[model samples]
Target chain A: MQVTLKILRFDPEKDKKAHFKSYEIEADPLDRILDALNTVKWYKDGTLTFRRSCAHGVCGSDAMRINGRNRLACKELVGDIGKKITIEPMLGFRILKDLVVDMEPFFEKYRSIKPYLINYEDPPATERFQSAEDREIFDETTKCILCGACSGSCPPFWSNSEFIGPAAIVNAHRFIFDSRDQGSDERIAVLSQSEGVFRCRTVYNCTDACPREIPVTKAIEQIKRVMLYNR
Target chain B: MYRGQSGMWLWVFHRLTGVGILAFLFLHVADTYLVGLGPEYYNELVFLYKLWVFRLAEWLLVGAVLYHAINGIRVVLMDFWESGVERHTQLVFGTLGLFLLLWLPAGIFMLKDVKWFA
Candidate 1:
């Protein structure tokens, strides 16, 4: 099948504004969008740039707006997307180049939530033990790959860059609900601020756009409930 | 345009209807305040509202308010119930269905007395 990949391209050194560049390539229906992108960069145009690692969707590096939705290129099959695909970098981020956005701000928000577990108690004899039920509470959030798909799809994050996005909240939820972790107080304080979980308008875009299938909006809502009742 | 699904459309509609309702509230407050200015000013404003254009706008306002109120309930449901998140798409469709159920009859009745294209 001949697929036309309409990619939003920008070259800081030359182009004054971003523009779409189309490339027609022969591909199998079962071929992943990442494969098509690889064909374009390797054969059609060497200047075509995108980020991809472990092109099996594990690394979460190749997330972009595919056909006006945030999706990992590696996971979306060309068969599902039809012949013509309009690809653009994720929204709510600075476009550093073609198909790449500056993720520094995103990571800073992730850092602000203190994503890692915080336990000041003495170390266990071997390791911290947790029952299966306790693990299940945050099991869904642990699948987050930080692909930025959910956060980028969010309208509030698009309108206000400072809004600590769904990704950060999901990361926070991971630690906040853990039975072994003891940082919920501090994390809740950070998330209860103006730019925090309240900024979410229950749009559910984050839940829809998650490549990992994380229930993002639900997690944020759960955080809201925790803050409300626990306080 | 982000080709988002039912959830996105609901959010967009909710926001637009909310803004529309707020604008109507401002207009309503100003019009109600006209009573203090005397019966003449208030009656004049009321007469203007009886015009066909304003009557049609009133129908739209009714629909907007209905949809916004119904969808607001959906948001509240989703916020409080875990199952609401799982069934949000259904809830959105249900909200729209309920809005249509209530708004259709109200709109028809509101516009029945208006003379259009006469």
Candidate 2:
């Protein structure tokens, strides 16, 4: 019938610091979390602010800390949350407002690893084609949508943000195992740097938070083993 | 090492400290190689090396080494020792405590002597 939502809100100027604000919402058992929040902002408080490019969890712009874990707001159901639902901005990022975190640092690390494929030669007149087996290796990695969920869930990134997190490494894996890419050695060399792949402790938090169900820890370890043998 | 687990964090810390040790090793070796760069460079190098910053770095280095060594033993025990399997987590904490025990006195001595080059 009714669920109490405790959301963390911070207005840099007005509040001067972060605090949790609670709101009551009445909705059906099947309503998505976004629907509940929308109901709250529409009728109760118009000052509530959060980012959502897609209400269906496709764009991943609604990733936040839901009940002490990193997840997309649109994906969580209000009925499923135990007791009280706690919403906060994603960890390990600069909170812009209520439930919104600046993801520039996460994107910077993604760009630092040269997330694009390093194709040595051009494709034919038509397009580049590959066997099913070859595509399978990188298929899971490509499912990542650059969401900051994994990086925020990582403990190492909490200590030192420079540690190229699992999200970036997973992006790199999409290219590292690409059959057309000729930069395996180059990517491995770059990753072997101090804060590169070696910084990963194989914590597997990335794998746990990945909504795409990609085998992130396995992919990172594969890159690690490549660096090891290649050296 | 997945979420809601213990050894996962420990393993991560161990490898991180391992990398820290490797970087320290490279820097230390490169600095020590200056001894062969003739006496004038060596004297200047030693003079600069014997500073408060260097002493602080030494303290951090000792901490890293102690962490790695103790964790490595935990790993080794996990690999060996018949009764160690059931007691693995306890062994990890025990050795980690041992490391702290050893590091505190070693650190005190280093600060008391106050000799960076020595």
Candidate 3:
């Protein structure tokens, strides 16, 4: 079967207007969206530029807006989405080309929360062992691959753009809940500043668009409860 | 502002109305409670209500209330088990649009000179 791909194109040198360009490709129902994109890039359009680290869904480099919804191209199969699909760069970021968004701002927000383990005590030489219940607190959050899908799917991030979005918040939670980490007080203090967790209105759009199906809203609500009780 | 997405837009409106109603409630209670001074204070507040500025405030208040109430019901429905799982988006905008159409004229006239709480 053939599917029509309406990919958003922007050419700084030639075309000033950003427009949708269409390409038809033949593929079976089981084929992943990445396979279709590769077919178009190799045979149909030489100028098409996109990013992919692993052909599988692990690396998360192929995250983009597919049919106006955030997704990893490698993870979506054409059979599930149907015969026609529209592709665009991820939202809430600077579009560098066809499907690559400037993720520097995304990473900057990640770093603003200080996304590393901060413990007042020294590490034990042995592997850190904790009860399964303690690790369960942040187990879902740690599955995030720094994908911009959650941030891109958020509307506050769309208008305000400066609010540290769910991706970073989830990353922060992964460490914040860890028993070994003693920096939650500092991190919560920092997050309580302007344009922080309070900006989220609980739209749950980020929860909807996340490829990993991470309970982003739950994480946000958990952090919000922490922030509320701390002060 | 992205078009053609029903569920997402309802989510956006839910977010806006949720915040809007909270802020309105804070301001409204403060204003109403001011009348506790007595009839003169209540009458004076009503007199303030008679003017164009307070009238404008009342109008926006009416709008915010209507939007919040209508959208809040939508939220309640979405929270329910059966009906929300399928018709979440359709129920939200369909009800909101009907609410606007049914109440627009009455709301506009009721906003003027008419004592909202009085």
Indicate the worst ten consecutive residues by lDDT in candidate 1 chain B.
Answer: B77-86
On TM-score, the candidate that comes out on top is: 1
Among residues 3 or more apart in sequence or in different chains, the pairs in candidate 2 whose N, CA or C atoms overlap within 3 Å are none
Off by over 4 Å in 3: B1-7, B14-64, B69-118
Ten-residue stretch with the least lDDT total in model 2 chain A: A199-208
Evaluate candidate 1 and give its CAPRI docking class based on DockQ.
medium
lDDT of each: 0.93, 0.78, 0.78
Measured over all alpha carbons after superposition, the RMSD of each candidate to the real structure, in angstroms, is 1.4, 9.6, 7.7
In model 1 chain A, where is the ten-residue run with the lowest total lDDT?
A: A222-231
lDDT of 1 by residue, A33-124 (tens): 99999999999999998999999989999999999999999999999999999999999999999999999999999999999989999989
Highest DockQ against the true fold, candidate? 1
**TM-score of every candidate:** 0.96, 0.69, 0.74
Q: Give the docking tier of candidate 3.
A: incorrect
Candidate 2 lDDT score at position B90: 84
Model 1 CA lDDT for position A65: 96
B74 Cα displacement, candidate 3 (Å): 9.7
DockQ of 2: 0.07
lDDT of 3 at A51: 91
Model 3 steric clash total:
0
Return the candidate ranking by lDDT, descending: 1, 2, 3
**Which is superior by lDDT, 1 or 2?**
1
Instruction: Give the Å error, residue A201, model 2.
Output: 1.6
